[model samples]
Target: MKVIVFDTKPYDRKYLDKENERYGFEIKYIEGKLTPDTAKLAAGYDVVCAFVNDDIGAATIDVLVDVGVRAIAMRCAGYNNVDIRHAFGKIHVVRVPKYSPFAVAEHAIALLMTLNRRIHRAYLRTRDGNFNLNGLLGFDMHGKIVGVVGTGQIGRCFIDICRGFGMQVLAYDPYPNPNAGIEYVSIDELLSRSDVVSLHCPLTAETHHLIDAKRLSLMKPNAVIVNTSRGALIDSAALIEALKDGAIGGAALDVYEEEAQYFFEDHSNDVIKDDQLTRLLSFNNVLVTSHQAFFTHEALEKIAEVTFENIANLSAFRGNRETYLANEVCYQCEKFGGDCPKKNHKNCF
Candidate 1:
């Protein structure tokens, strides 16, 4: 199949190219993201491969459908960018579901470890040859309560890691997985009891701004929050307020709510306009990464593999004629995967 890949990067090409021969696909890589204006580039291609940041809204989808683009293969896990309801009968949408959950789960823990151990500060100081260890003290993670929101594969893997450190795992998922030794609880209880709270939920109506001003207040004074899931899951403005007021101890974020325009790009020379993000960056306890939890070698390979498989499935007649093949973890294209939400229907589906 002939595929036009948008939002191409050096690593994306290097990794995805390794499996192209097996899939019988020739991908035309475009460096820039596929905006509505640029959606015309998908003409004559049978499929379009998109990244998380690429805007595949109504306009873009209309353009792709007009150009005879039959299917969309999302290289990442989330499909919030796509308007799935509109594309249901017109085009098929598929994604890479659970591509190396260990990669993301481990990165969440890595950010937490880096923040708590003062390793970020220590590295900066030693680079200038300060050699000061006076304020480099850090506490241990043993016997602490870690609240994990969303008991998906990544959350379960994170719980396993925390359990290895002798930490108690408190999880909050509408549908709880009982195999991980995680005790499911309410949001208030998880916030009040946890020494560390980690977020692993997808972005939906119910989960959007799940951690708001009121929820922030419920957390302990010394509690730490880590989010490697969707950015909108936590309210950034409320989080900044909590951090400024010392309501929470620390925050380690690999994803931010307004990261689409800036995360994967190099805008270091330009002045960043997001005031809340700027203010959050000023704090020493807050650590931010560019949504890179799924950048591991294993994850990249799996992403390419699953994405191609999704394309293959859509090309074949295995799925229904109205809609294309939907990824198993794709809540956007499909219904809520296995009844996690209290509601019967998915928001965008």
Candidate 2:
């Protein structure tokens, strides 16, 4: 099968090329993100492999369909960028549902620890020969409350880590998991009680801007928030306001709402035009890492393996109407509790 990969980076090519040896599918790599303008590059290809930041909206889907692309293989778990409703009858969409949850969960802990202890500031200070320790005060994690926003694989792993630190965990999920072994409280209660708030939820319409001005007000003034999940999950503008008003202690982020134009690429030589982003960078209390919570070796290997497997499965079931793609995401089915009305159909399209 012919496949074109968008948003191709050096690490992505290295791992995907290694995994592709098993399937031996013809693949092309492009450094640019898959947008409506770049969709034409997939002409004559059977599938398009995309990453998190690619634009898979109606316009891009239409372009892919016109170019004879039958399917989209998302290497990451989140599909919020894809217009699933519009692509339902136009193209098939599959994704890597999970890949090394520890990679992301561990990163969240790393962020929290670094922010709490002021490790980043310390490192910078010692490097420049100014080893004064006046503002490096930090508290103990033991016996502190940590609010986990989601109870999925990554969130569960984070909860385990927090437990190891002797921290109390309070969870909040619309659909709580009975096996999670933590008390599921309302979001407001969790925010107000937790000394640390870590976000691990997916980006959905209901979850978009889950942490806003009102919700931020519920948090303790000394509370710190860590986000390794989707960027839009926390309202950026509200967060800025809260920071200015000293409503929250600090923020550690691996993602940003307007990161598509900046993240993954080096812009050190250029001026940052986004006012919000620039303001965010100016805060010493805030720590920002480009969306790289899932950049571990194990995660990359699993992502490559699962993505190719999804593509191969789609290729094998092209003409068969009885076979169902397990990783295939249908908006209708997802919205209605996994009971797809078109169960007998091979693909939503």
Candidate 3:
């Protein structure tokens, strides 16, 4: 199978090429994102592999279909960028759902620790030969309440880490996990009570701006929020207002809502035009990291393996006319339940 990967970085190429040795698939790497304009480059390829921030929207999907691309293999877990509704019966879509939950969970804890202890600030201070300890006081994590917003693999791992710190754990999920071994509360209660709130949910229409002004108002005055999940989960403007008013404590973010344009690229020489992002960086309490929570070596290797597995599965399905591909996701199945109305179909296509 021939695959063209978009938004390729050196690390991406390195790991993907190493993994491709097993699959023996012809692969092409493109540094540019897979936008509608770039979709034509997938012509004659069996599959187009994209990353988290790539534009796999309706127009791009149409172009891929027109250019004889049969499948979209997302190297990352999130597929919110893909227009699944438009791609139904047109092309198959697959993704790497879980690629090192510990990588993201550990990164979330690192952000929380860095923000709480002001380690970033202290590092700069020490480097500048200032040894003042004033304004550097941080509370103990022990005996504090932590609200975990999602109890998926990553969220569960975070909860375990918080428990190891002797912190009380309160979780909120629409579908609570029975095996989570933690208290499940309403989102409002979690916000009002927790000293630290961590988000680990997917971005959906329902979850977009889940942490708006109203929600922020419910949080404890000294509560700190951490997000290693989708960017749009928290409203950046509302967060800024909350920070200005000191409504909550602070935020440690690994993703931004409008990060597609700036996250993966070097922009130190360029003027960052995103005013909200600029304002976010202006706050001393807020710590912003490029969307790299899932950038560990293990995670990248698994992503590459799963991505290639998805392509190989699609190739096998196409040849043998199988009923289903394990990692396949479609609008009908996602919008409804997991049950697709198209019975015994090889895929949505």
Q: Considering every candidate listed, which one attains the maximal TM-score?
A: 2
Model 3 residue runs over 4 Å out of place are 341-348
Q: Would you give me the overall lDDT of model 2?
A: 0.94
User: Candidate 3: TM-score?
Assistant: 0.97
Candidate 1 per-residue C-alpha lDDT over 1-349 given as tens digits, one digit per residue, 9 for 90 to 100: 7899999899999888987768878789999998888889999898899998899899998999999998888898888888876786677687887799999999999999998987999999999999988777767899999999999989989999999999988889998776666688998899999999999988877799999999999999988999999999899999999999999999999999989878999989999998878988999999999999998999998988888887777667344544424573334424545553533322333
Q: Best-fitting candidate, measured by lDDT? A: 2
Segments in model 2 whose C-alpha atoms lie over 4 Å from true places: 344-348
Worst 10 residues of 3 by lDDT: 340-349
Give the per-residue lDDT digits (tens) of candidate 3, residues 93-117.
9999999999999999999999999
Q: Poorest 10 consecutive residues of model 2 by lDDT?
A: 340-349
What lDDT would candidate 1 get against the real structure?
0.86
Off by over 4 Å in 1: 318-349
